[model samples]
Target: MNGIRAFGATPSDLALDPFDEGTSSYSKAKDTSPIARLQERIDRGETKLSHDAQFGYLLSLMEELGVSTHSQLLVFSKTSLQRERITPKTPRALYFNDDVYLGFIPGAPFIEVSGMDSKLGGVFYSIDQGKTGRPRFVRTDQCLECHTSTKTLGVPGPLVRSFITDADGVVDMASGTSLVNHRTPLSERWGGWYVTGTHGAQTHRGNLSGREAFALHEKEPNHLGNQMDLRRFFDVSRYPAATSDIVALMTLEHQAHMQNFLTRLNQDSTSALRQFGHLNMKK
Candidate 1:
């Protein structure tokens, strides 16, 4: 099989831009939020934490198989996010599709599969090689098929019912109060609920309407305002990858998936051959 390097004559030969929306910020204050924090981490660092020795080992195996880069892999997690923390029990690595990668549009929620666990948090992915385009949100229904079914893994799936907590950290589903007891309406809890009004009587205008609503929502006392706008949150032009690091990252990710596929095939063949031998003896 041809390696990515083979497909492209040289790394510099690849036609790509390095300016990733995920890495740049127009408003430094906006980028200080939790979602942006996580994005920064994911963009600049490796996925494994120091405590994740086993996960690191797995990453090594992946790297050996050519799954070491950023473009080829899409990460998903079955955990909710908070303004400060992410608790993930079922983190999955999948292949990136064109739609999923570049789907973060101007009006979308910047939803991220990795951040689905928390109402306050969202996820976004960059599709354009340089991360110049908008980041799109991942919808709740889109995740329900695999996340809602415990039969597949026996763990609680992705679908979760969350309520705002009061200052005492008491969840008041009736009033939509959160740990701070800000008296936030249930209608505005998660981005999805806030956008769709599934949790409360309030109906959020999709995209364009949402933007108009956000301007109004920001004026309300105690509202943190909508922090999901990439343009408002990031400086889209200045990133370390602005020099073609994104292309490199995507190239690396693609190589990793290819290697993983080949590795899986080899393992399958070995298993099949063993099965055949066992059947012959039994016969």
Candidate 2:
């Protein structure tokens, strides 16, 4: 419950420069991510990605990266970098494996992607969906603005957030948002998302896409609980899967932060060893 990040009360957090070349070297590090590896294969002509008329480059990219289509999860919150086109009717689809997360907006020009780096924690990239001879995953820095924060353990990492959203998928700032992980209670999870499955009595904030639903959550929180189908929320035909699985969502929430924790530990240990020299502890 108490930590250096909670209030910045300790100078310890400032001890390591995450971007320093000699330390973590987040920006300078040659990230050995799966996306980067796949890109190399394409550049060397060792492999080529398929682009389809129906799904664009989605299926091919997923195949190249080894991400399962069944791991798809839907988030309707308008808190994305590409928020202008996202809505409850056009929620963002995220498919992931243990090492990577790929985000797709139905009509967007490109697919957003992030993958784990042994040194950089999370490396962000994008793949264009338009017709082209060769597709490339361009690494970007803009994603770091939000991806690196106390919530991500001061590392460039992925996050699964929960917020109070309105009908058009706009988040209500007054309602406050939460950085979710496994530590988060089940009842408080999944706002601004569509979760399809059946839970007899348990409740979450998923499938509530109205201002009134947020307020009603104070009383009848389960007003939208246990939705076995998502046909009414959006066109199920538009996405890879009709169901935004609860198991996948929960696993994603936990995995995202577990990566951050690993990065934090790696960063701090590297920095501390360099700064204070080796420990002479009493074994």
Q: Could you say which candidate leads in TM-score?
A: 2
Model 2 lDDT tens row, 1-283: 1123323222234333445455666676687999889988999999899988767799988898889888999999997789987899999999999898999988799899998988888999988888789888888878888888777877788988898788998887666456888878878788889998877788888999886777787788688788888997779898878888999998998899789877777776666656555454423
| Tens digit of per-residue lDDT, candidate 1, span 53-80 | 2222222222322333333221111123
- How many residue pairs clash in each candidate at the backbone level? 35, 0
What's the CA RMSD of model 2 in angstroms? 3.6
TM-score of 2: 0.90
Tell me the spans in candidate 2 whose CA falls farther than 4 Å from its real position.
Answer: 1-22, 215-219, 278-283
**TM-scores, one per candidate:** 0.20, 0.90
Q: What is the C-alpha RMSD of each candidate to the true structure, in Å?
A: 20.5, 3.6
Counting only residues 3 or more apart in sequence or on different chains, how many pairs clash (N, Cα, C under 3 Å) in candidate 1?
Answer: 35
Q: Look at candidate 2 and give me any clashing residue pairs.
A: none
